[model samples]
Target chain A: MITLRQLQCFAAVAECLHFRRAAERINISQPALSAQISQLEESLGVLLLERTRRRVLLTPIGRDLAERANDILKSVSDLEEFAHGARTPLSGTLRLGVLRTLGPYLLPHFLPEMRRRHPDLKLYLREDPDDRLLDELTSGQLDLILMASAPRNDDHLTVVPLFREPLWAVLPLGHRLAAKDSLAQADLAGESLILLEFGDGLREPVLALCHAAGSREHADFRATSLDSLRQMVATGLGATCLPALYVDAEALADEQIVVRPFDAPAPARSIDLVWRRTSARSPEFRLFAELVASHLPTVVTPL
Target chain B: MITLRQLQCFAAVAECLHFRRAAERINISQPALSAQISQLEESLGVLLLERTRRRVLLTPIGRDLAERANDILKSVSDLEEFAHGARTPLSGTLRLGVLRTLGPYLLPHFLPEMRRRHPDLKLYLREDPDDRLLDELTSGQLDLILMASAPRNDDHLTVVPLFREPLWAVLPLGHRLAAKDSLAQADLAGESLILLEFGDGLREPVLALCHAAGSREHADFRATSLDSLRQMVATGLGATCLPALYVDAEALADEQIVVRPFDAPAPARSIDLVWRRTSARSPEFRLFAELVASHLPTVVTPL
Candidate 1:
């Protein structure tokens, strides 16, 4: 029978591709780690790794098996988390994955308070790109995730809508649009717009807005972050749209840039708290989501 | 011959996994794109895509071939860029990849000046994680990259040292260490250090510093960006290290946070401008490197 320990050892080795480092990561002796790998291979009747003097590489089938092993390991971890949650609703460690765009701006508004209220709850935070955040949550590496957009109809997950953050137009101080109280989509036509790269959650909606306004994304620049987009705008490179929470957190005080709202029926993204459908901590998660919504900055409307 | 057009059409399809969207992305008719894919597959004598009414999927070998086709497309793009560069030294488009950690803080200091000096030059910027930046540069998706550390002894690239930016300890107001004039590694012992997540160029160095000082990273938190780290510190989560340029750019005025330099032999990261050795525009790139080094903020030591 395949044991969870074997899968854990194999997953570690697959990630590091070095037996010694993998052993160190898992807090085991080198010989013990090697023995488990060999034992698993013998039992399965398939070679999993190719070892050279200087490097370790996975076989083709080994690559596919490693992915499966990781999935199994994630399920086991989720089971353990379920057992822990049964004993204590919110006291144990909760691993949370978050979108890079939302984490920085949103967390500061509520993290300290959350920590104060649940002193026994330890939150392990990992912020990543949107796709990776979903991947990690599905793999059970994260107990929950906070993102601007949830999968439309993912059957395997539960999503709690937290808030709606409006996208505001940001421009250099002397730009022609800066004089307007609230810029309409048509008002932005013919302007040079800057945006985040394709994979960023904010990019598509911002691109759609630009397209609606007849504005073209600057052919020469795709910012990596909201901060980068702001920096470019400050340098007079191009105008951009930033979320209200982000603008409130950092840009409100910047004299070099101007932040204005869009006309009614403004572009906005829905922030969600998502977790696996099979999670045992659903009740606690719902309560936690309520807490987040209650404390959200006034710039965003709670869902 | 497998024409570039066929590969372009196939790569687009591989990315979108929908023929209509792929055709729209590449500005070709759906039938025209489908014809190219079929002709290419026939010549190669392999089924590249499995098409059904609802969706498209790549075959196992098709996935690998698609990656290769994309690489070839990138090289072709680079060849065109080379020809464009040959016509005018700095008048054409230049695609530059930048590290997310460095771009926001560093670019504003020089980008406006760069635009002023080279009016005809159109600079396209893409900011990505460290590994992706290097991969894109090697694949010819980017002509140049600016990063904290260059790959050592890489035969395929030329690296120009830019400057050394010191890491500073940031703390909440009224914290125990906030009163100190400067801090030594020993002073950080027993402190909880917040850090960027793994894969960020700055994370490893910050972790090393934490290790050297007997400090332990806050296991519960791994920030996605430097700004996120700052926000966490502001909320009294823990102390963190940030680059001097970033501090100079954003943190100096924050009333809730105090930034301090490290003691003698302060830990720092080396910034470099890197490009493929085979690039035809070395002279122009070298001149661009000089201009960047010259305009670096006073907080860093230009190399």
Candidate 2:
């Protein structure tokens, strides 16, 4: 039988893809890595690697097993994290990753309360786009992800929907259409629009609807960041679609902007708290998720 | 932090109610169960159970926590099942529950093949209605279920569809509808139908449509078992709707019976293998499920 240590060693080595580098990453001797890999192969009755001292490459079967091993190792790690997270007063490292766009605005609303409630929870926050957040979350680098509902594939993460925020058109207060009571997709056909690129996670729904309506604006301004999109919108450059939660009274203090209903058959984005289902930190994340989902409804939704 | 052993004891005691019965159930002394309950209360800083020589009942918080404890225990049981299933090939007590209507026809067709394939799998085959099968599946008594899609409250189980079996209308030889190349819903609405009832699991869909169309015919007979249904149909009692897979070559060999296409948005049943999502048995059950799902396209729809 292969030991958990062997699985850990193999996973660390497989991830880094370089023997010496993998050894350095895992803090193990180079020969020990070689021996563990060899021993793991001997136990499993399958050759896992092809090493020539200079280059180490995974065999075909080795590659498949490595992927499976990663899942198993992750499960084991999640259970360990679960045990560690089960302490009474909640004193431990909690790696938090929030999507770049939502992070700046969301922190003001929820994190303050979370910190106040659990002062002992040492939260290490990182701001990144949803894609990187998802990748890091799955790999055990991050415990929780605060991102928009438009996740393409959510295989590893258990998604708990926080709330559905109705789509509101964000535009400069001085724009001609801003004065209108209600705006429809057809109304924005000739108007200038700004949208985030692919990785920002809001691009698909924006592009899909625009394509469906054959909009003529062609998204004249593209911003890689959500904050950048907001900054541009504040400057009177173009209109953009955004969730209603961000433009509440406090957020509105940033700039003079008109938020209007986008008409019938409108779109809504689901803001969700997603964490890897196998994370031992899941219950902790889940409790936190429930707190946000239940409590933040009043402040977060664009009622 | 509640120890797993304490939760197990609490659950057993809760189920048994009598201290001695609970002790016997857990193979522990009565004093130990009482001790663990007291220790659990000490850890939580609250009384969990109200106990006496005569009876045992939960406190308000205990009752509330019983719900969460059930969830946690279910999760743990699923994890153990998953681990055990992964380690061993499908063997031991495999409690398999299948729908009543499908059970007879399906088991005869595939059981022999399945037995030949997995000799170690001791199939404790059960023929039940969908509701019972679903209940048993959720309670962890039944490892896997073969049933049609229905609205089941499943927070723990994962339902993955195996295949969609198209419905075929079976009729007596030289019947008016069978002479036609195809039959529509309208053609059979007013005819004497051998419709399966609640235990047959088709009560809802069949009744819903017939009721909506205002064309329900007075059924001459209803049978709990498929064998009786097949015999009734063979003897020209009334026409019945069945998936193509169950009406095998042997059944079609009946000179007095005929099969025809049922038309106008064909009625189909989606068969799936349902198991606990967190089950340790998932990995092996998935492999077994895959074999069945793969063999199913040919077994169910008829190539």
Candidate 3:
């Protein structure tokens, strides 16, 4: 007996926490929204909202139902989207989640080609840590993701290897390491290394490389982003490691930051395009992945 | 620039993958649904669906946009839900994601009290692995969670320690060790142990206990759930260890499985109620946690 319209009204009112504002959001008169809420409550045999002079509140039942209603409405919306997609494979908006380390350097090179190929395609981009991006990907909040070191073992995911980019030692312009033509792992011995926070996918391996080189991590500081890490190095904070793509795209522009590659046995992270295995857009995603992989080496040399 | 109505219509159509079925899903006449799709495509300046005499398909762009539109609509719905909830606090539905290992043996005992105290509160429950549950907790997909080994170090999470539960060794009723009134760590030496698959929070500690006892995990048979492990022991399979609460509530019901406590220095897993620190429903969660803790020991003896 419940209707989407009633759920919409309830969601609107609950979100606005104001009957008038909710009514405005849904493009309905305030009394009309109130009537819908009453009808929903009556049908469910539970009170969903408690209206005071100053605020509108959701009862416990209201909260539960609102959560379920939101899921249902979203599912319904997803269904329609899937239907439309089946009819026109390359013409709508694409929501992409990319790694903070990879997106800035990677997307600019390939997205223009993607736009050229599918003139009607619109891209919505988000950049975050791999853990957060993968979480949203699994939850259907993100359509596809570009990430590093995807767990190939996860049966629920499909991963397309895009490129493997080496790690570069980022040093202040005039540092001893920067002046060297090339450096071996032993050359970094006793060096102070600063790195990104733990969850970024870039951190663990970078830490491992530093430890292997007999370098110690800076005890007091961990940068939140690659830009910040570069800034720290530029200001003579400490030397650090970054992916080659990032150094090429952003760090090279900074005269104070010098990027140098490891002499041999260089460490690199594999970047991949990953998505839900069950997604209806699998073919399209695969095609997009291939396009990106083919063009990647032109902008950032592949491993 | 996309409106909720257009997105909703698009989602419905995408789901059914058939124009008539999609229109029926939204309770609209097929022609009207078609008109709305046309209008949406016109506004977006792109063709969203491909129509043939017999079927409908999505352009690549259509698929991308549909996914993005779905997320936007869901966000809008969530915003509405949040606003309403701020006014009422705890009276709305509570979505609780609980660990598969703990929920069954724990919730039934205290849920009656939860119902009695806040009859208006509706609990929507999901049981998943700890990693998945924690991810959902952070992403706003779940309201609260009951899990083991709360990562107290995470500043974004607020954890309420409920109780500590001990692990019990389970064996067949007529086994030699089952005759003993109590068991010690050394008693399990040279014994064959069966365990749950890796990733369940219980696996690591159980493996450590086995190693301490000089026992090796059974290589071929890994039980998927506590009930399966109990059944294996009942049928004269290898012995296993389980939480005290699980042994009390579920394993004891089987006539052939015997549950025993350790002599001393028992290994235990701490159980806690966790939610996002920024959750507006913090006060309500705290009160609910208190109520559950008060009723806990009656059903599951605390360590």
Candidate 4:
């Protein structure tokens, strides 16, 4: 027979432990709250509060019951908020699954704006290679994934188009190609190109681009995190590729790596957000996605 | 607006994915349970269960709601059981307070039987010097206290009688008094009696009984645990006093010790059950107490 109104009234009184203060806070009349308390106690057949004019005491049993009431009320509140959020914008916990190659380029620009617009939003950013984030999102662990589209069909989610960002080639600071404004893919055919390890987001794209350019294979070095790849490139150990936004930052502190735009067919990668249509995404999630999409492209435009 | 009952119905339906099974388990008619779910949905202005004639599937948001529902239900169930068991007699947790002296003598025999009779009951036994349980009882932490009574006023709890057991004088198994039929307080004069350290529950009574016999400055040793005192007495050491039940078995265990009743106004420690006036000493706690007291006198029956 307990209603949300009753629970709200009870919770206020139980927490404040003062009838007048609880009533004042809840914007209800003190006499009404008192009458309601009397009615509630009579219905439950237990005394919840031992009140004196100047003191309030909780019976041993009352203390136990209050703890349960608090948990119940909180659960119900989450349910209501979640249900409402599902119909509007994406909200709650939005696990943004990202591709490693795209992550450093996109996140630094969009996250701050997303925070300003969607204050209730929480983003769990996971950067991996290829379509790995999409697979996790499909299995219900990760909520949404942002990655380059693959040739294989994705049955799990509805992929929405974001934007494509161009890729560039990186060489050591004193490399022979450092003085060039831009270079064709075949320009570095004789040199070994260091590759990232498996599941590296750009592994397939670079391989396909090279295969089309009539190269059998290039000298290969594999690295995982971006900093490691940058370290290899800075020491003139190998040539690797990068998204322009990553290298466009002021000047490289190492001053040894020369990053140049790709001149052949202007290689670019598609970035998209894939989420399970069968999964609950709150309104806050939608606002965050929109905010990121709006701010990210402008930030990447200078590149 | 969702009651605990409605949430129960919803959870059952969600988990079992069957209305008939859930309704039967809850002891409600199928139609009635379905109506409650419909009502819950209408109240929340959201669809919680996705139902088709052939199957019932949770909506994406409904899946999230179900997890929250379970948490709320579990807490609510614990609270309801706690509240209803208040006067139901040891149905759940019983916070038992015992004097340090009484615990060794009483717990060994009682705990095993209590466990057999009330498998679900949880006994939190606390042993302290005096009636510290009484303070806990008043503060709503403890349900009962097994302690020796003083002529002090207790406003919150009524006392129930526990068994009264006699005391015995402990000495080396083959000491001179080992063959005596019985000993008087006067016989203890000029003989040093080892006592428990200060703050022991039996100290006051033992000191009073010894002083009545004009046995002054006769202290030999002081101990903490009764076991320590008994071990000291077994080593051809000075005498230490103990309740009849403890040495009733130990006397037979060793030929070096003797068991004889004290004849001159032997000091008696009355063990009583102290419970808060508002205590919900469930049925099991009361039954368990009776089981304990009934077995006390037999621990050291007069031989």
Task: Please tell me which predicted candidate would have the highest TM-score against the true structure.
Answer: 4
Per-candidate iRMS values, in order, are 21.5, 16.3, 11.5, 5.7
Candidate 1, residues B1-303, lDDT tens digits: the string is 455677789999999999999999999999999999999777665556756455676643455567767765664454334333434556556788998889989999998888888877778899998889899887657878998788889977899999999999999888899999899978899999988876557887888898898998898998998888899999999899999989999998888899999997888888999987766567788989988988998999898
Evaluate candidate 1 and give its CAPRI docking class based on DockQ.
Answer: incorrect
Lowest-sum lDDT 10-residue window in model 3 chain B: B82-91
Which wins on DockQ, candidate 3 or candidate 4? 4
Q: Candidate 2 chain A — worst ten consecutive residues by lDDT sum?
A: A82-91
Docking class of 4: incorrect
- Residues B70-141 of candidate 2: C-alpha lDDT, one tens digit per residue: 555665454344334434566544678988766666666566667787776667888888888878766545
Give the worst 10-residue stretch by lDDT in candidate 1 chain A: A77-86
Q: In terms of TM-score, which candidate is stronger, 1 or 3?
A: 3
Descending-lDDT candidate ranking: 1, 3, 4, 2
**Residue A254 of model 3: what lDDT?**
89
Global lDDT scores for all candidate models: 0.81, 0.67, 0.78, 0.68
lDDT of 4 by residue, A1-303 (tens): 444456667778888888999999989999989887776666566667766456454544566667767777888877777666655444344567787767776787877766676555567778766557656765555766777764336554566666666667788877888788998877766666766676755666667656655443345567776678788878778776665556665224447678788775666666677766554343434555576677765424321
Q: After superposition, how far is residue A154 of candidate 1 from its true place, in Å?
A: 84
- Output the TM-score of candidate 4: 0.55
TM-score of 3: 0.40
Global CA lDDT computed for model 3: 0.78
* RMSD (CA, Å), each prediction: 31.9, 29.1, 29.0, 9.5
- lDDT by residue (A195-229, candidate 2, tens digit) is 88765556766776677655534346678865677
DockQ of each: 0.01, 0.01, 0.04, 0.14
